[model samples]
Target: MSAILSPRPLIKENDVKATLLSPDFLRVSQPKTFRHSIDVYLKDSNATGNIYFARHFEWQGICRERWFFECVSADMLQSLGVFITKEAQQKYVSETFAFQKIDCEVNTFGVKHCSFSLLFRFFVGGELVAVGHQQIVFANKEKKIARLPDHILAKIREYEVEKGE
Candidate 1:
């Protein structure tokens, strides 16, 4: 007889966020968030009818592009040169079944000389399913790392302050 393996479900009552907080008051603030929805298609599912692991990255890309076009202008992006992905990380809290609608919320949490970070959270039916973080760096037309343009940075700062972040 052959053994079949199935994905394990995340157990409740173990709130990951609670374990990481410090007792001392840390001045933490939420970023301005952008929300987008992804409708899972058959092509995005695996044999088990759950969304394929790699599809999460694809959805994240969609969310990121939507955010860029909405919050900033495509022409502005072109004028500023290119933004390249530096690093990406994700933590899957639960599985998403096929045909489900996943709500993705994204926000910029950190910015620096030539790079910025976007945090993404995926939820299914109001339950947190995954969290992702991506770092992107500005680059020149020659593909060399470059400092973010002041105008763009100023716009981002204005948006952040407007959102009370």
Candidate 2:
């Protein structure tokens, strides 16, 4: 168990949970989600022979960084200081067996001054198995929270689906 960081925001935040936790995308995939994947192995399973629940968190992290590598810029990330997941929530839908490939669709939501949300949907054989939501923020070397840099925002916006889509 690790300490969690949340509730702290650089400025007054607005209502963003509806967008971040919406299940609409599960029904119809978002058009611009950055997709990433993982092939589950025995090592990823528990004694019950199902994937260890924590592995979803690992997948969420892997997919998030992969999005940064493929869509966002690493150099830009380096410019921002440290990254922290202010909050993370997940819903386990069905049992996932070993050897099944999991496709994690990543999309940005609720962008704000110094934090934003990411929605992660895990699908196997085109069926939703799990859902995850994470809110992330960055801080400077002095431990000051950093706002979303314009270039990074633009890159994220490119992957954002229009409202009501």
Candidate 3:
């Protein structure tokens, strides 16, 4: 068997920051949409009541799962294998608070032999709050990197094309 290489970040940190700051960042339409409501208990706030930085990732997880099921069938995903996050990065634009309902728009940004990238835009009350990028790899039961199934890839492409319409 050949050695597996780790996935690299598709965008540099500086580029991510620039993209997040752009006026059109949140304006870009994504193929898949997931909505989430922030609860008081999820707030890992300091004395000043600002949410902890890490909580953003947890919210991303919620959206990710929803996006997966929405775009691809859960049964198909289970039959193929598990998708693992090879790398993830987030850039926060504005502070978010409890009781805010956010819309997470996600798109299959890119695809490779063994992995794919998902870009997420978090919008709260029409304001951009944060942007997240995740590189996910499909792994078989043996935990070895596996190629994406053709059916799944086709579904992703369909969504991408639909988004452009």
lDDT of 1 by residue, 74-159 (tens): 66487658989889888899999889999998777577778787788899999999988788888988898999878777655532
Pairwise lDDT winner, candidates 1 and 2: 2
How high is the lDDT of residue 93 in model 3?
Answer: 100
- Checking candidate 3 for backbone clashes, the offending pairs are none
Models 1 onward score TM values of 0.74, 0.76, 0.69
True-vs-predicted CA distance for residue 127, candidate 3, Å: 1.0
Candidate 3, 1-165: lDDT as tens digits = 897776987689999999999989868664544455555444567667677778889878877787677767766477767899989999999997665666777777667667777777788878998988888899987888998888888766544523132
Q: List the residue pairs that clash in candidate 1.
A: none
Candidate 2 lDDT tens digits, 85-114: 999999999989899999988888877768
The candidate that wins on lDDT is: 2
For model 1, what is the alpha-carbon lDDT of residue 11? 48
lDDT of each: 0.78, 0.82, 0.74
